[model samples]
Target: QVKYLNNIVEQDHRRVRQRTRSMLGFKTFMSAAKTIAGIEMMAMIKKGQLNIPGSTPFEQFYALAG
Candidate 1:
């Protein structure tokens, strides 16, 4: 049970790690927070996690941006 739960958590972290790996690192806390939030938002859109009522992820993201 514990191993199963840990795998689930690790999978999620893997996505974040892959995305951030090219950036080297963040210089400030605020910048890191914003960048991570944007990354997560994009990931959610790609995963169809947001219900913005759009046929495509780009449209959904635009709606949220406005």
Candidate 2:
């Protein structure tokens, strides 16, 4: 049962692996971390996972921004 769980994590890591491969290298780990964070955040937003209760993600973002 636990053996199958790693596949889920590996699948998630595939996106980051592909991106890093395409970019070759970053100047610093911070830059790479920020890029990965942004990519994951965008994925979550696109999947409607980042939206606030009773609000769209864009609306939640705007509310937090102001």
Candidate 3:
């Protein structure tokens, strides 16, 4: 049962795992944090998880950044 539950949790993070795997790793904690934050933001936008108004994902990301 615990293994099943863990699989569910791992599936949720699959996208993040795939993204980070290609980066080859980070050199600093701050850079890793920033890069992960951006990755999460893009993932959220792609998943329609945020309600920010914008015609495109880039605009929505800009609105959030600005």
Candidate 4:
């Protein structure tokens, strides 16, 4: 049976898959996991979920980094 409920997951994974396709080699699972984590983190930041108080998204990253 075809499950339509997982469409949301497939949609979310599309970007991640595209990102991985661009990259060359991942030596191991740990490295791949780290890459995915970084991709998701950027996605959250872009969505403003990780924005710091009183700062725009771009500024928030700078604040966190510096």
Candidate 5:
């Protein structure tokens, strides 16, 4: 279990570095970190067809789907 955990961390570290490597180093590290966090989040969201919350106006959505 410890070895498996290390592997997960290793992969995540490589991916995060790769992502930030393309970005311009910001004036402040905290600013850069927040921007990277937001970009990563948005990238995850863009990866697939996201399910919108079911709380939408269902009649309109149903009509649109039809």
Candidate 6:
């Protein structure tokens, strides 16, 4: 669990910076960190570790949450 958590945290931060480079530069580091974590969840779905149902691109993972 620590590995997953740490990976998410690091990747999230990286993605947030990538976003900033494109547009919407964050004014605060803390705020960007939180937002990054949220977006990271979606990005990590590419790993397909949860085995979500259906054949959707990423929406199937959302289905498994229910």
As for candidate 2, its clashing pairs are: none
What is the TM-score of candidate 1? 0.75
CA displacement after TM-score superposition, residue 6 of candidate 5 (Å): 1.9
Q: What would the per-residue lDDT of candidate 3 be over residues 1-63, giving only the tens digit for each residue?
A: 575898877876788889999887999999999887887888888989986764699988878
- Per-model TM-score versus the true fold: 0.75, 0.68, 0.74, 0.65, 0.45, 0.40
Best by TM-score: 1
CA lDDT of every candidate = 0.79, 0.75, 0.83, 0.77, 0.58, 0.63
**True-vs-predicted CA distance for residue 8, candidate 6, Å:** 9.5
Q: At residue 2, what lDDT does model 1 achieve?
A: 78
In candidate 1, what are the lDDT values of residues 1-66, reduced to their tens digit? 575998888776677889889997999999899878777778888777886763677777667655
In candidate 5, what residue range of length 10 has the lowest lDDT sum? 42-51
Give candidate 2's total backbone clashes: 0
Ranked candidates, highest TM-score first: 1, 3, 2, 4, 5, 6
| lDDT of model 6 at position 12 | 52
Residue 40 Cα positional deviation in candidate 6, in Å, after optimal superposition: 0.5
How many residue pairs clash (N, CA or C atoms closer than 3 angstroms) in each of the candidate models, in the order given? 0, 0, 0, 0, 0, 0
* Cα-lDDT of candidate 6: 0.63
Off by over 4 Å in 4: 1-3, 56-66
Error of 3 at 28 (Å): 0.5
Give the distance in Å from residue 14's predicted Cα in candidate 5 to where it truly belongs. 3.6
| Candidate 1 Cα misplacement greater than 4 A, ranges | 1-3
- The window of 10 residues in a row where model 3 has the poorest summed lDDT is 50-59
Candidate 6 accuracy as TM-score: 0.40
The top-ranked prediction according to lDDT is 3
Angstrom error of the Cα, residue 53, model 2: value is 6.1
lDDT-superior candidate, 1 or 6 = 1
